[model samples]
Target: MNGLFGENLKYDLKASLVVFLVALPLCLGIAVASGAPPMAGLIAGIVGGIVAGSISGSHVAVSGPAAGLTVIVLDSISSLGGFQLFLGAVVAAGLIQLILGLVKAGVLGYYFPHSVIKGMLTAIGLILILKQIPHALGYDKDHIGDMAFEQMDQHNTFTEIYYAFIYNSPGAIPIVLIGLLILFLFEKPKIKTHKLFGIIPGPLWAVIAGILINETYRFWIPGWQLGGDHLVSIPELTSLGDITSLLTFPDFSLIADPNFWLVAFTVAIIASIETLLSVEAGDKLDPYKRITPASRELVAQGTGNMLSGFIGGLPLTVVIVRTTANVSSGARTKMSAIFHGFLLLILVLAIPGLLNKIPLSCLAAVLFLVGYKLANPAIFIKEYKKGFDQFLPFILTVIAILLTDLLVGIGIGMVVGLFFVIKTNFHRSLVVTELNGNYLVKLQKDVSFLNKAPLMKQLSTIPPGSNVVLNAVKARFIDHDIKELLDDFIETAPNKDIEIILEGFSNHVRQKA
Candidate 1:
């Protein structure tokens, strides 16, 4: 047991470090965009890693407050009168998530249509491309926002494209070019020949190269400044006193507001959906093919959110960005996630100066690649071949998410998927046959409330003065509602001059009906 757990621990630590590096800049950037202190993002990241990761069943999944939630968090904070009040909603949301997990609501994740997942991936990729363009060009007017295409219209992404020629920063071009070069080199087969070079990831190499290029440009030409605004700046917090002062508490007084409950419920639902989706993606990327325990993940997320809220941090959930980075970085266990959180804590305390030097554009390039992979055309083609029932809902899900938001899009897709499933079962069960002088009707598998509508329509349309037989030989289960419907059909059959025969009507079937 020790050996097995030990191996996992080692793997997780390695994975966590990689995830920490990837998550650090993102946490700050997202918090900045959400109109909150940068430290709020870091605090959430720490809680998500240590608190959530410790309890989560997922080996590779990483949790944090995501950019996707920024708008909601910001709005809640504004309306609630302060960030502390918003924290109250987050705490409430965490409790709701915990209750949902206990009720085994995670099963909902399994019912999501494949097409919808594909569509979501595509939409997210498109959004990443649009949002990252501004960052790549050194315009930090807004944070990388939602997965919607139209949302981009409201931000600098639209404006920066037109202004690029007129207001382009000279230093940005070199930094972006160097970052791209690093990415190219990492992808090149020739570079793999070198042992030291092959061990490093493309994103890490790009960050290093970006730093070097910025320093080199500054040294050669003192007037050409590229270091300050273009890069990630670690917030100045000198002592333990400073850190203590930063901590915020939830405003329990806000509990009186009905809007608080509404916001809390919305956050819980959306955060759970996002977490479940990320778990699915993380499992896909796991080399061991391990399936994450969904209920435990919700519990972990809940705990993390609770802690984050207590510390005046943002709401937390399983984020795809850091999880993907963890997988790609060869993370093998949950320790990587925990260690990543620890690393975040240690780095913030010890080496804020070093972190402040890294350029944001370099990070943007890394995210750009991630977005591209998520929305690749190959995924669409792959899902399309799964059949119309699969692809249609997936396409609808993608469009819905892009046009509306994640939860609404997924809800629409789920409804469509449920309809298809019910229709398929109904069509399969519907068998009409002439047995001797009687017309025989047979059901396949189980018949439930979903099959009632179609069954009623078929029964009402049956030819008058015809004999009918209802067979249940193939049905393993039937709902009471369906049995009642059958009873109604029997009572009315004689009035229409139709003879009725019921087969395999056991005591159990009668009770069930």
Candidate 2:
């Protein structure tokens, strides 16, 4: 039991610090993308770690304001007329998620196809690579949030990449190049073998280097020194009282609005699904192979979302990036997750001014590597060899995401995958073989309405005046269409002098006997 709370104290502390560093920029960036105050993202991180981490059944899954929910939050805040009203909707969403957990909706997550998930991850990775080009080149015009393909400032994604070189920050380029070099160098297999280098997480080193370099630039190269727009920005706080003032309470006055309920419902369903998927992914990443309790995870997330809303924060999900960072940094227990929340709380309250000095390009370098890892071409080729059934949906998903957003792209891939599923089932619905002066028809495990066409086609080819054996020994489910087809065949077969022997049709065989 003690082991779970950072039982390996050294490992947990190092991992917690790395996750905190990775999350700081991301939390603020996602909030900015959501059209909420930067502080809202931090608040959600605080609750996600302390509150959600405490109740969640997952040992590794980290909760925080996720980029996936940015569209929903942005739209909700805009349509609701104010941030406070949207907070009310978030609270309602939490309650609805609680009800969903109670009803055991967690199993629904399993319904998502594995290929579709791979496609989703690959698409996100590609998007990250494409979008981070500007930040890497030190063009921070749209640095705070780069989730959408079409920028709110009227610039599209590709143009921003093209403009990055033309308007690149001289100081930022060196910082990014050096930062990326250090990051890549540290990840070498040999460096990982060294005890000293192994203990210092790569992202932490990159951040420290970025901060010192930026400070040095300000000292010597003041003209090209990066400022707030090109750096991480945590609002400086004078005291605990100042932090207290920033907390916005949720306004429950609009809770009665039917329209509000619809928004809440949307949030709850999407959040739950996203949380469940993250939990599954986290459990897979766990070195110990521990299973996460999905329903309980929903409850924990619900509690965190409600607390975040109460404090005027963006909605939280079981965020995959932070969880992956936590895992990669060798987190041993839930304590790392809880400690991350504590760190966010202290960092925001204690040293917001100092944290802001870290260059945004350094963070972009980190995400760039993360994106490359997720969308590795090796993975694409691996799935490609699995044949068209897997590769088609996977590539289509990546292409669709390039054209559209994440959720829409996943939906498109799933729809395509479903067509393949039906097509395969239709082809396998029935089988026919010929024996000594007789015919045999074998029914598969599931014979549904979709199988009707193929089944009839196979049955129609049976030779006239030939004795037939209909086999259903292993058929678990026979839909009405299949049964009616069999009944009509039995009635009309006499016209062709076809004698049929039925197997595994208990009632009909008994009646004839």
Candidate 3:
């Protein structure tokens, strides 16, 4: 244990604390969005960090309750009758994922296009910035938007800005401005090398500042004070017995229920895809450039969910926001992720009141930086410069996800991307170069049916009284449709008063025509 973590234990400790802070509000927000018990998200966060991190192949991919699965979970709870019954579906989903991992089905994650993944992240970042604006202005809503355009509140995402502008809190605006300033200065080259600011993480100081600012309002400046509704609300645990009571077991009798199987299958597939993409994203951010073992990821996620379900936790997946925060904080090993779990467990039990005093606005500031890093304008420009093929799919993905859901958005992008792929292949199949009043037709080694229309169109443009040369010396495979077209063209050559020439044609092909 020491060998794997001891070399950079200090760095891991710093990163863990930063990640823990960033994850706290998101966990609470996602749980609220899912319509489960508030503690359910916390439980999933702990298990994901401890169990999944312990076994996961990637050093920085952190698992927890995902916002993407919120809609499915919400609907399942209603369809399956209640939260306890829904736990059964989660358990079933985990078992199915275990089977999939055993069969090496995790590689399905690799088939997704890179442009689609980047667009997915970019859309999430834009959503993050847009949604957090309300919290940053202190809207004081119990249910925060969970990184989606179609919010859980049944309102479009733009409504959040309306709420922020109308219901803005005086106390929070200052705290957020101060928090953002602190983060900005902390990142500056001058402040980074300072003796004190360099050692302690910027997030810890931000939390402390938030706490102090709110406390000042609560006591000394009661005239403009903020209420508890505006702060983080972690349920306080008064006794050791309180911890055990939070655990809830699933009703196993639902195993025979067909509806349970349907929900389970849906969750398993969606969770697997989200986890795989997050793992790939984390790998891109790895300074060491190491590839994660994809198969091991499925096993770890299945194990975490099984345990989480048994204990009344929300579904778990690798989350991109926290994963990016982990990278930003300079996490070196999986120990940083595991340690963050332990920190979550300790703090939720030890000082729920202290945590509750933290204003959501400060946390929003932290997330704003993370969001901008993911959706950098420089990246968008670079993608555009690559070519329209890459940029178009990326733009489509971002727009679709911003207006609809994740799966649908990615599907739209993939379809657009596939069209470009087929188009490029069509151009390469057969070449027609005209010279000296004659047309030279050079067929490539392999040609598919997709090229037939283009090939036929080019052949038709051969003006009357012109010569034609057909070359297939390097051809290996030709579709029957293409051969038929060539045969028909050859037989009708006399009608157009055009000469016909065939070079390197197969004897059988020559004889058949």
**lDDT per model vs. reference:** 0.76, 0.83, 0.84
lDDT of 1: 0.76
Model 1 per-residue lDDT tens digits across residues 95-124: 999998988888777656656666666666
Q: How many backbone clashes does candidate 2 have?
A: 0
For candidate 2, lDDT tens digit of each residue in 1-513? 335443677777887887898789888988987889999999999899889999987778889988778888989988888999999999989988887777888878777777777887777778778888899888888744456677777887788899998999888888878888988887897875578887787877888888889889867999878995898888886667676788999887877788789889999988887788778767767888888888888888888899999998888989877887788777888878999999999877888788888888888887777778778899899999999999998889888877777667877988999988877876676788888868888887777887788778877888789999988887778888778888888878888989988898873222232
TM-score of each: 0.84, 0.94, 0.92
lDDT at 317 for candidate 2?
88
* Model 1, runs deviating above 4 Å: 1-14, 99-107, 145-153, 156-170, 184-194, 219-229, 239-241, 255-262, 433-440, 446-469, 476-502, 505-513
RMSD (Cα, Å) for all candidates, in order, is 4.1, 2.2, 2.8
> For candidate 3, lDDT tens digit of each residue in 1-513?
235557788778988998999888888888888988888999999999999999899888999999889889999999999999999889888888778778888898887778888888888788778778888898856355376676646677788788788989888888888988888888887876778787888888887898888889867778656666678878787897888887777877777888989999999999998899888878888787788888789999998889999998998999888898898888888888999999999999998988988888888888888888888898899889989988999989999988887778888988988888877766776899998879999887777777788888999999999999988877787788888888888888889998988887773144223
Error in Å for residue 270 of model 2: 1.7
Error of 2 at 10 (Å): 2.6
In model 1, pairs of residues that clash are 12-335, 12-336, 13-336, 16-336, 115-394, 116-394
> Best to worst by TM-score, what's the order?
2, 3, 1
